[model samples]
Target: DAGVTQSPTHLIKTRGQQVTLRCSPKSGHDTVSWYQQALGQGPQFIFQYYEEEERQRGNFPDRFSGHQFPNYSSELNVNALLLGDSALYLCASSVTGGELFFGEGSRLTVL
Candidate 1:
């Protein structure tokens, strides 16, 4: 994905822990979306933000939260982490709910 990237490509955490992952959307894209991909499973939508507002969200619990910046960059924060939270967290960019281009993702492993 052009201009889309994530930080802390890999990380480790423990139960009851919390982590914040960051993403920079593609240039000119006004929306950012987050996804969680467990091993051997397809990505699951976590949430989407635009205009610095959360515009859409998936079925994930309140523990999953995010924010979008004025520059279109974004962040995903997961609190009270569990082993089950281990996954590749992807950040995607689009134009107001248009087609998406995804970053490589940040891998999180919990023990």
Candidate 2:
């Protein structure tokens, strides 16, 4: 009965570096969505994965990408990371169009 889970809890990277964050969705969930939350701001949708395909994406640049596994788990990868890319990356799982359960989030800091 585990809820959503995110790995690496924290990270530090330099500009232009690439980073990958992982997530395990809650049981019985089939949709995984990635969000970025900067300090003092609300979460911004990065993209969503369903059936191993990207079903929807936000206003983020092309550098942000994601994948969904058979078990409904997911990964978020950011290429050529920038200072402004540093934020709390959240993984939210839900039965498509239903209520979502969010993970603790992986914090990234770019220097």
lDDT of 2 at 75: 93
| CA displacement after TM-score superposition, residue 8 of candidate 1 (Å) | 1.1
Candidates' lDDT values, in order? Answer: 0.93, 0.96
Give one clash count per candidate, in the order shown: 0, 0
User: Deviation in angstroms for 12 in model 1?
Assistant: 0.4
Q: How well is each residue in 21-60 modelled by candidate 1, as lDDT tens digits? A: 9999898899999999999999999999989999989999
Backbone clashes counted, model 1 = 0
Candidate 2 wrong stretches, greater than 4 Å:
none
lDDT of 2 at 73: 93
